[model samples]
Target: MSELRKTPLHDIHQSLGAKMVPFGGWHMPVQYSGILDEHRAVREAAGLFDVSHMGEIDIKGPHALDFVQMVTTNDASRLHAGQAQYSLFCNHNGGIVDDTLAYKISDGHYMLCVNASNTEKDFSWIKRQCTPDFDAEVTNVSSHYAQLAIQGPKAVGILNSLADKDLSSIPHFCFDYANLDGIDAMVSRTGYTGEDGFEIYLSPEKAAQLWQSIMKAGEKDGIKPIGLGARDTLRLEMKYSLYGNDISGETSPLEANLGWVVKFHKSDFIGKEALLGQKETGIKKKLVCLIVDGREIPRPGYEVYLDGRNIGLVTSGTKSPSLGRGVAMAYVENGLDKEGQSLQIMIRNKGVEARVINPPFYKKST
Candidate 1:
C-alpha cells in the first residue's frame, strides 16, 4: 500500500481535536471545531487552514517560458515577474487534466501550484515534455514546502503583525518570496474564497510557528482554525469548482464553463487545437449552476431533467448555509443551459423543482 502523507501541522490539528480525514492521499483535518462554526468564522472573521497537501513544482532556466507555453493553454509571455495566473492543462482532445496556478517568480523561473491528486501524473507529464533542447528543470517541491492560509476580512492586519515586508503593495494574484519571521517564505494574495486573503508557503519546519504567530496576532479578530469541510462550502458558495468532483481528466474547460482559463492566442499549447475545434463546433455538454426549491439537497450524481426529459447529472451540490437554499452544479445538455431556465433534480426518486441561475448563489456585497 502507498504511504499516506501528513502535513507539518498535523500535530497541531490533533492537539486541537480536529477530525482528521483521508483526502487525496493525505491525512488532513476535515474540521477543527465544527464545519458550520469554522465556515462562519471565515465569513465573518478569519480562519486558518493547513493546505500543505497541495503540489508545487518549480521550473527554472532559460527555456522556462517556452516549456510553459507548450504545456498550458494560457499565454505565459504576458505575465510579469511576481504575477500569478490561473491556467489549465489539457489533453489532445481538449479534455482537462487540471486547473493550476502559475507564478512567474523571476525572469526565467516559474512555480506551478497544482491539485494534490494530480501531483505524480503532472510531474511525469512535465518530464516527458522536457528535453535537453530546452535548458529547464522541473522539480517537485511539494514535500519541501508547507502552506497555510489566513483568510477573512482582517487577513491583512494579521500578516502585518508577523511580516516585516510591506504587504499593502502586494496586489491580488501577486506574490513575493521573502523571509517571514526569520524563515524563507512566499506569500500570495490569492485564495479559493472570493474574500481577500493570503496563502503563505514556507519550509515545513517553520509551519507550526508561522501558524501560531498568525493565530495569535489575529486573536483580536477571532481567528479560528478551519478545515476542509468549510473550505468546500465556502468555495461552492462562490461557484468555484473543486478538482475530482466538479472537474476531472475526462472533463474539458469548454464543458466546465472555464474557457477563460484556456487562451487561444498563445502560439501553440498541448490542447489548443482541440479546444479551438470545440469552440467552432460548440460543446455538447456544459456545466451549469442551479438553485433547488425546498429543503432536499441535490447531491452529486443526482439526475437532472428538463420537461421530463433526462438532461444532465449533478457534479457538486450543497445546502448553502449562507443562502439557506440548496444549490447545485451540474453538466447538462448545452442547449438547455440558460439563466433562469427551469429544471428538475431527482432527489430520492422524486423530482424536485430547480432553476438554472447565474453562478455564485451568494455574491459578497462589495
Candidate 2:
C-alpha cells in the first residue's frame, strides 16, 4: 500500500500524542486524550478539529452559476453572496457522486467543498461535464488551504474573541471574510457535528499558528483538539451522512433522506431524469436509524433482518456516546422501514434486537 498523506496539522497531532490512523488515504488522528473524553468535551464545552484533508474546488466566470446549477442537485440561484448550501452531485443514473457544500462567493464565482477521498474524481467528473460552449473555469485548489472546525456551545464566544469582526451576525450557513488573529480566513457558521460552530478556511502556512492561538485563547473555556473518533460519533449522533459509509456512488440522495436538497422545479440537472423516474417508480430500499437493544455494537456490513429474513445491510453503526446505546444507520428493504419497527442486526453470528427510528438521536440543547 502507498504511504498515507499527512495534513498540515500532522506535527501538532503527533506532539499531542494522537493515535494516528489511515483514513481516506490520510494519516489522521483517531483520538487524542481519548475518544469518550473528547466526545464529552465537544458536547459540554468546545473542541477543535483539523479538517484540512477536505478538498476545495473553485469554479468561476460568466457561466459558473449555470454550470453549477446543471451539475448539482440544489438550486444555486437561491444562494446569495457569502451564503453556503448543502448539495450533491449525482451520476446520470441517479447514484450519488458526492455530497458537497456549495459556497457562493459572488454571482459568477463559487467554491465547492467536497470529500477528500472523492476530490480528484469529483474534479475530473465536473471538468468533463463543462462543455466548451460554456465560459467557465474549474480549478482543483484543495492544497491551497487548511481547514479547522471549532464546535460546541461555547464555540462562538471563544472564536469571537480572536476574530476582528462579530461572528454572531453571520448566521447559520453564512460566511464572511475575516482576519483571525491577523491571519486571513474565510469563516463560516458550519460544521459536521450538529453543534453551533465555525469552520475556518485559511492558507496551510498559517494553520499551526492559528491552531495554537485558538487553543490558548479558549483555554479558559476548556477547548482541546479533537480527533476523528469523536468526530465520527458526534456526526453519527446528528445523523450526518458520511461519504463512502452512509452515502456513496452506489446510493441515491432520495433513498438516503436527502430529498430536501434535490430541486426538480429548476432546469434539468445531472441525474434529474433518473431521480424523477425513481420518485415515480418509488425507491425499493430506504435508509433508517437503528438503536440496538443491548450493548452489542452494530457495525457496517452486518445483515439486518425482519421476521427472521435478511432484509438489508448496516452502513454505519456505533455505540453513541451521547445516547449510551448502540445506534446505527442501515438500508433496509422499503416495506420494513418504519419508525419504531423492531428489527434485528446480526453481530458475530447472533441477531441483536434493534428498533428502527428517526434520527438526530441526540437533540441539541436549546
Q: TM-score, each model? A: 0.98, 0.99
Encode model 2's per-residue lDDT on 289-355: one tens digit a residue: 9999999999889999987899999999999999899999999998777889999999998999999
The collision pairs in model 2 are: none
Q: Model 1, 150-244: lDDT tens per residue?
A: 88888877786777788857999899875666767899989987777899889899999988888888998999999999999889988898988
Superposed model 1: Cα runs more than 4 Å off: none
* Residue-pair clashes per candidate: 0, 0
Against the hidden true structure, what lDDT does model 1 obtain? 0.88
Best by TM-score: 2
TM-score of 2: 0.99
Give Cα distance to truth, residue 198, candidate 2, Å: 0.6
Where does candidate 1 have its weakest 10-residue lDDT segment?
176-185
